[model samples]
Target: MRGKSAKYILKVDDDMWLNFDVLLRILKTGAIRFSLGGKCNYGQYPFRDPKNKYYVSYSDYPMSIYPPFCSGTAYVADSDVIKQILTISPNIPFFRLEDIYIALCLRKLRYEITNIPGFHSTKIYPLACLYKSPMVITSHGVSASELRNIYQASCDKDGSMYVPKNPQQLPERMILEQRWPKGKLARKSFKYEQQLLKHNLF
Candidate 1:
């Protein structure tokens, strides 16, 4: 897995809305080799559900080390480290809670797993904050509606403090924003091209 390529792994929760353009810019800086997405505590885990057959916690096993936080999202290590882990533990037992298990394994191997701040959500006014935060992770606790509200609001002109565009141009603008932020006109045109391709309008 150790090879020279320009790529970064981001594990995002299903409910999380990432500004891909912003993320791409961050990746371009090359300061971060691996990144993990913050969790939004909206979904239920198998361990929490009473119906699950395989559910175990650190409390059950005294020797097991519990992760500092639940791992809804995490960054994969660089290719070399990834290869080492794969080679060393190719046939590890399949855990229902793979996120925490992976974190524990990485920690045991002396890999640093960082928690990104400002990437989370709260019950207050704005559902999400789109700040240029040094920390890159955030979570929302058990509020799917809030997540959707934040997403929609972020895409709205009047509602969103970030990327506010007219409703008619919102979709195209969003696509453009994801692709290229510096070249506004080019991004808009590129968005049109993308729409044509998606709808076979060409």
Candidate 2:
């Protein structure tokens, strides 16, 4: 599919379960010249709001053009766009991480990457709510088992529109804190500096 002139690309996470029929129905809009699907997350960073500092909404700021951020899944402009991106001078080095690089490329080209809602795990809570207006395009930090449970429960409920899934078992605070050992110091200093550079804050 990457080699062909695809009209759209649907990127799916390992755990995502989608209703293609429903997706097709919603994407019939003419404004969308091409479509991309996948889970995206805005990088973690804080922003200043005049009076004080606060964490920016992931969907806002530099990533606003891409809307939902962190490109695990998405569609691009077929092989042409892909080829052009790959051909850029000082070709981007091959890295273990690829999604951010792709997002940066699309950003440089001024492409509009919109979110396709209702394309997330069916096992998460309030699955039916995804069908409502103002759709949700992505989910983050969910494990494979959690995704499986969601799919199973969605099936068991006979596709009822409003079935609620069990609350997710969140990781312990000790674990969470372990993941961010430097805490406020790291965020206020090193992380802050990196974000400033990425967003051109200076």
Candidate 3:
């Protein structure tokens, strides 16, 4: 990371949905430079059950509460912070939770973790109305087709595909199917939207 020319590093999971335009806009504002992501498991206790995937033995981590850490789904760290973490990692005992481990390293260096509300840790519906907001940064549980639909809806200029955020602003159970285009797989994507509308799921 120290050898890289980029001043900041953005680490993202393959499953997460990212809006590069919005992220760039945020960076341009200079509000977030060091480290920023959704903070989760702030004071969570280490898993004790051996069957659990996150189980941590006393030898690995004797501490009960984990330090506040950002969700590993997606996060941005300054280049210097990345280099510092690598330099000190060998001394600090390894932990299964990489995010928590990184937080511990930051704590040792006396760096603050910046939490962004835009970074959701859980799955979120890629609704067109939500994406229109410049504050919306990342969403989880996004498929290829859903990503296409959301991006298209965001770029719509005719106002035909505009959906209101409030249910009261539109008709009851009225779905603007035209806004959500069925790209490569027509039926599969359309049916998924129909099911979502039927269940009022978002």
TM-score of each: 0.46, 0.44, 0.70
lDDT (C-alpha) at residue 106 in model 3: 83
CA lDDT of 188 in candidate 2? 49
lDDT of 1: 0.43
lDDT of 3 by residue, 1-202 (tens): 2357877788888767777766766667765666545534567788889999888888888888888888888888777788888999998877768888888898888777787756766555555555544444676656677666666653443222443444234322222332444445545456556544643324
**Tens digit per residue, CA lDDT, model 2, 89-159:** 24553322355566656655655555544444333232323322134333434456544544444232223
Residues 35-121, candidate 1: write the lDDT tens digits: 333432323333633566656754553443355433554342345455545665655544556676565455456665544333444
**Residue 170 lDDT (model 1):** 38
**How many residue pairs collide in each prediction?**
11, 6, 0
Instruction: Give the top-scoring candidate (TM-score).
Output: 3
**Descending-lDDT candidate ranking:** 3, 1, 2
Global Cα RMSD, each model: 13.1, 14.5, 7.7
- The local lDDT score (0 to 100) that residue 83 gets in candidate 1 is 50
Rank by TM-score, highest first. 3, 1, 2
**Best lDDT goes to which candidate?**
3
